[model samples]
Target: MKPPDARHSQAEDARLLTDQNELARQEALNGLRQFDAVVEMVEYHLQPEHRFRFRPSHLLHLHRLALEGISSYAGTWRPASIQIEGSRHQPAGAHRVPELIEELCDYVNDHWQECTPIHLAAYVMWRLNWIHPFTDGNGRTSRAASYLIPCLRAGYLLPGKQTIPDQISQNKKPYYEALEAADAAWSERGTVDLSAMENLLAELLARQLVEVLDHATGGHVTLPSAKENPSS
Candidate 1:
């Protein structure tokens, strides 16, 4: 038999692991609740003749929602530089985030009519990921902001049992590849090349719409109800 101290240490380790897992689960639940709230707000702004203008504050608010229970830094820009893992791309310096975000908002507002909704949404997602404005939850915030673009520009929430954000999270390889492709193009030639990301977004949106059609035609998939929260 093992020594009593050894047995006690194993038990203590197990308890710590369990506690960590439970904390992760609770954090996920809270994030989902916040995502639902953000979705509701997006829908509200998309109402007829509401005239919503995309702004830096909107991104800040969405970031806050995405990390409501996970990080104290939610809804605020990072004060220190951040690095992306497993990628060659580097985000802007911490001090430049505020100005860059303002430029992003202004660019979107000015080009709202010039670009198609899908292109615009893709740009937002890619740029936010590139900016890495927050200390954590940047991807979540970016995806949420990306969803908001199509809804706001198209004047309604896109219907689906699964959203683009869900699809991106489920299969991140393609998403990351697309972002990296855009990054490479910009880094090499100083031009914003979002065609790859645009294609991915288009495919996801198409799949989402197809899912909606299937549900309407008696498919087995259940649509997200008003009370349904996003899965983190």
Candidate 2:
């Protein structure tokens, strides 16, 4: 059932960071905290007895970190419908968010062993954006969750100076294109064809790793093509 408060007014949901400059500063600070927290959480969950299980709470916690001082809606599912700018895809209704997020977690847990790290990460990134569960920080939370899944699956944090999330944020054209590709596939058929997104992750991950190697070797290292890296 749609909750009585499911139609939050735009004015009521206005951000706490009224100043654009302050908002940008907070975004930078919050992003650091969010990334550090994700790494720490990944380490904690890596313990043999404390295996990771993707849950709705995980997303909420990450969202909270991403928008703690920026939005009044931090740490919670959006209470009203939101429209994605520059795209035709409509987010799931506020009433459907909780169930959709639950299913997303289930998808990760159900295929934890079978899916490649890149595939799992790509799926999480795309699906969470598709769900658009939070009133704010959906992108931040989605990217954080995407990084978390692969780190947990691999049993350790992945190494890189610039992570997949970091790269995507720096220049989002390719990222948006990949997401659009997946959306088009879903519209054409009921399948989750994440090849484009998967490929994007694979490429960015390789670039990140190569940067690490270049720094480690003092610019005397040879790197393999992204396609050659089976780890992605």
Q: What would the TM-scores of all predictions be?
A: 0.82, 0.90
> Lowest lDDT 10-mer window, candidate 1?
5-14
Cα RMSD of predicted structure 2:
6.1
| Most accurate candidate by TM-score | 2
Clashing pairs in 1: none
Decoy 2 TM-score against native: 0.90
Give one digit per residue, the lDDT tens place, for model 2 in 19-124: 9999999999999999998999899999988888889998898999998999888898888888776666788789999999999999999999988989999999
C-alpha lDDT of residue 85 in model 1: 62
